[model samples]
Target: MSKPLEITNLYKRFGGLIAVNDVSFKLQPGEVVGLLGPNGSGKTTVLNMISGALPCDGGSVRIGSTDITKMKPHRVAKNGVARTFQLVRPLPTLSVAENVQLSLAFGKKRHWGREARTLAEEKLAFVGLEGRGDERVGNLTYIDQKRMEMARALASEPELLLLDEWLAGLNPSELRIGIDLVKNLQGQGMTVLLVEHIMEAVRALCSRCVVMSAGEKIAEGPSAEVLREPAVIKAYLGDDHA
Candidate 1:
């Protein structure tokens, strides 16, 4: 079942540099929300904290009614939270199916052997990677690798999915395909928190947006309206543009 994600007072620091400061946001069940900001705006850092890839200096992350602030990455995955990295991460040595099978084995349902492979294939098909399961990850094109990563994330059967620039580096036609893939997830009632710089994809996929700048939230509202905020404009294009 789909679940809501609540991030409260999330704080992160790297020595003297504060990467995130008291950031808070919520993803209601089945809602697609965009987390928008410029580079180094702590958008990815927030995702890391929520996914347990990084430890929070202060704050809490909760999915549904369960607190996951201190959980490790695998624990977080088991709790129905899965994410794709800003950089595509795949085990090049493994076949596409094996990669997703590994994720399925570690997922909430913990399917193994043939069961895992079957479910992995299903996810692969869901991400438009059908019948490419036996192909080596290293041989797949860049966009295909991205699709495989999404398939691997889906193998976990997550309630909440976090995508970090999953649409980056795609051509116009590929971008449309990528946007449609995310739309398919939304149609399936999956809660999504997307960190993207692609305004077109954001406008097409997100109903609402939360804008962050220099580790702080500067704006939040309907996607169209929030993008019109001067603070958001400044955050993206600087003072002169605003």
Candidate 2:
């Protein structure tokens, strides 16, 4: 059964610097929640903690009733969490199909050999890569690489998908395609936690938004309402913006 993601009082520290401080939020099943803030606001830190890419110094993360705060990244993936990075990290030496195949092999339910290849193709098609699976990832354009990343993440069939600044650096047309792809994922019942600096995308895709400042959650609620909050406006655009 699918479960809601519950994060409570999570914290992270890098030496003397507190990267994430007592942040807490819940993502109900099938919800697309945007995590928005300025650079260094701990948005990605929160995602890292939930996905087990970084250990939390304090607090807990739960998926339904299971505590996943300290799970290894693979274990976290097995428990139905998957994520993409702000910088696309596809295996550059491998074909696009091969990258997706690797994800399928290591995903929640592992596939092997030919089965993995077939499934990888299906996933590539899902992300609009369709017949381009044979091309090496290094040869692809930036937006196509992003699509490959999404295909690999979806190969895991995760219950909760974390997207970290996936729309960064795209031109207008690419941005529109990216937004539609995210909506398509949501339409297929995937729960998402999106970390994006693009407010338009956040407004278009997220039903709710969480705003952070200096490692703390300062505001959260409906997307439009939260974005207009005095604290949130101040954090993003400065007091002058407010």
Candidate 3:
């Protein structure tokens, strides 16, 4: 049986600044939720804490009944979590396939040698990079690099996927493709926590949304209803958008 994610009273501080303040949310299995906020609203901080990239100041994080609040990043990854960065970070010198292979080797179900390579090829194809696996990551276009980032994360075979601004900076066509890719993941039963400023994408992909402002969650509900809230309009979508 799979467990849903539960976060309670999560907190993160940077000296005098409280980046995330007593935040909590529960992700039902197989639900795509949007984490939305204006700049400095602590959206990324929550993700970092959940993914174990940053230690939380105070709070509890649980996957199913397992306590993962203090786990290391790799341990978190091993616990069925995988994430992609807002800024894609590929191993510059590694071929695209090699990069995905590295993720597979360290993922929840670890693979190695020939098995890793075979899995890496499959993941690349999943992300539309099939025949280009041998190309150096540094040589790929920005959109392709983004695909590589997603492929590497998918190689981990996570039950919970944290995507931070994955659709940022894409043109209309690319944005459509990116949205389709995320939808495909959802269709395959992957639960996603997406942090994106693109309202169109959010409305299309998120069943529910959590809106943040000044390190606190101000609104949470169905995507369309949440986006129409006055607080969300003021803090994130802006009056013009509202």
Candidate 4:
């Protein structure tokens, strides 16, 4: 059976600002759902709440029937959800393989397991970073660093992955590679939820998408059609959008 993710009537507020309002969505295993919106449109807020970095005021988040809305980040992660930050944060001093080793072990359940060096190496190879594990993470290029983050997330073996603006800094080839990586992960049965500004990438990678504007979900469905939505266009493509 495919694992699924569900978000119900989610709400997040800070002072007078409602960063996310009444947002709800769901995803099945092996699905890639794009969470699309312009800047300050609450996309990251939703991801943060799912990842347990922020508290939701009025809603629930669940992965395969497990309620994770109010759980701590660690607890939520242990329930089989993992996320990558907009700013890639690899340990500069650690070797690339070491970074993956640490996250694969600690990213989910309180690792304390065997170091499993071979497993770490295999994960590095899985993410297209094979043979480079001996290099310090600080020395990798921007795109390579991002791939390392993906590797780290995958190392935990989560059923679901959340990515925030992952393509923002990549070159064209790198973007293609990243999309291919996501596709491969999906083929391996991992679900993905991504928040992105890169429309072309969104069009290529997502099977469906949820569109947000001013902190609310305005549209959700097939990616191509949803991108044509007026709210999605105005918020993301400006008045020039059709």
**Candidate 2 TM-score versus the reference:** 0.98
Tens digits of lDDT, candidate 3, 1-242: 23588999988899999999889899988889999999999999999988999998999988888888999999999998999999999889899999999999888988999989999999989988989888998889888899999999999989899999999999999999899999999898888999999989998999999988999989999998987788888885577766
Better of 2 and 3 by lDDT: 2
lDDT of 2 at 63: 91
30-117: candidate 2 lDDT, tens digit per residue: 8999999999999999999999999999999999888999999999999999999999997888999999988898889999899998
Rank the models by lDDT, top first. Answer: 1, 2, 3, 4
**What TM-score does model 4 achieve against the real structure?**
0.94
- RMSD of each predicted structure: 0.8, 0.9, 1.5, 1.6
TM-score of 1: 0.98
lDDT of 1: 0.93
lDDT of 4 at 13: 94
> What is the clash tally of candidate 3?
0
The global Cα lDDT (0 to 1) of model 3 is 0.91
Better of 1 and 4 by TM-score: 1
Q: Which residue pairs show collisions in model 2? A: none
Query: How would you order the candidates by TM-score, starting with the best?
Result: 1, 2, 3, 4
TM-scores for the candidates:
0.98, 0.98, 0.97, 0.94
Give the number of the best model, judged by lDDT: 1
Q: What local distance difference test score does each model get? A: 0.93, 0.93, 0.91, 0.86
**Candidate 1 lDDT over residue span 1-242, tens digit each:** 69889999999999999999999888899999999999999999999999999999999999989999999999999999999988998988899999999998888888998888889899999989899999999989888998999999999989999999999999999899999999999999999999999999999999999999999999988999999999999988989999
By summed lDDT, the worst window of 10 consecutive residues in model 2 runs over: 1-10
Off by over 4 Å in 3: 237-242
